[model samples]
Target: MLETRIKTRSDLKGLLMDAQDLFRDATTATGSKADELRNRGLNLLDAAIEKAQDAQSAAVSTSKEFAQSAGEYVRENPWKAVAIVTSAALLASLLARRRD
Candidate 1:
């Protein structure tokens, strides 16, 4: 689902870029054709903004769910959580020392 959202956002971004280019090109035209291109560009821009907002909402929801699940796990296994953190810290310190 996340991958799909990412792809969708990428597609929308590409489309938005295309729309902007079209709009810029429209500036070189005269009268009705220019108006049409500008209108089309605005429509595409609006759609891209809407989809971007939707992706952001989904990401926030997914993060909240993961955070909630992690909280539950830590509550259920406090000692194990502490052990994991300690081990991770030790590993990080060792890796950092190696870089020096």
Candidate 2:
């Protein structure tokens, strides 16, 4: 899943770079060539936006699943969850203080 997200981000980055190049080309182009370059750039940007939306949707779904599982665990073992959270909070605060 992480690898997929990373790859998606990488792909999006490349698409954005290509779109930028197209737009730059359009700026220096004339007549039909300029219009074609602009259109291609717009299409690339649209594709990148769609891919980003898909990745975001997947991340939100995964986060909701994790939250649901965590909630179930906490309900099943209330005291254990409290202890774990307390320990984590204490450790985080201690580490933060040390950093300060």
Candidate 3:
């Protein structure tokens, strides 16, 4: 019976060591996976920022061209442009008053 008890204790110690090793391996694996995910997230964010910058630059260029064309059109039709502006102003004022 004493020999059996000693053997059982030895077996328990070995199992404990194995459990500890498994826990350590799991922790290391989780940390490595987290680092990989973090790197991927940062890369995606950088790509999104670059795409946004490109889109903003395109929008600015388009706005400039549109403004230039509109200016020429307004100069060619001064009375019509004035009438459109007045109508827009009136509409804006009416909308503002309604909001209030």
Q: RMSD for all candidates, in order, please.
A: 1.3, 1.2, 24.1
Worst 10-residue stretch by lDDT in candidate 1?
2-11
The local lDDT score (0 to 100) that residue 91 gets in candidate 3 is 100
Task: Write one digit per residue (lDDT tens) for candidate 1, span 1-100.
Answer: 8687879878797978989898898989889999989988988888888888888898899999999999999999999999999999999999999999
Q: How well is each residue in 63-87 modelled by candidate 3, as lDDT tens digits? A: 8999999999899999999999999
What Cα-based lDDT does every candidate model obtain? 0.90, 0.99, 0.68
Q: Could you tell me which residue pairs clash in candidate 3?
A: none
Off by over 4 Å in 2: none
Candidate with more favorable, higher TM-score: 1 or 2? 2
Worst 10 residues of 3 by lDDT: 15-24
- Runs with alpha carbons beyond 4 Å of true place in candidate 3: 1-31, 94-100
Off by over 4 Å in 1: none
What lDDT score is found at residue 10 in candidate 3? 60
What TM-score against the true fold does each predicted structure earn? 0.91, 0.92, 0.56
lDDT tens readout by residue for model 2, 1-100: 9899999999999999999999999999999999999999999999999999999999999999999999999999999999999999999999999998
Task: Identify the candidate with maximal lDDT.
Answer: 2
Q: Give per-candidate clash totals.
A: 0, 0, 0
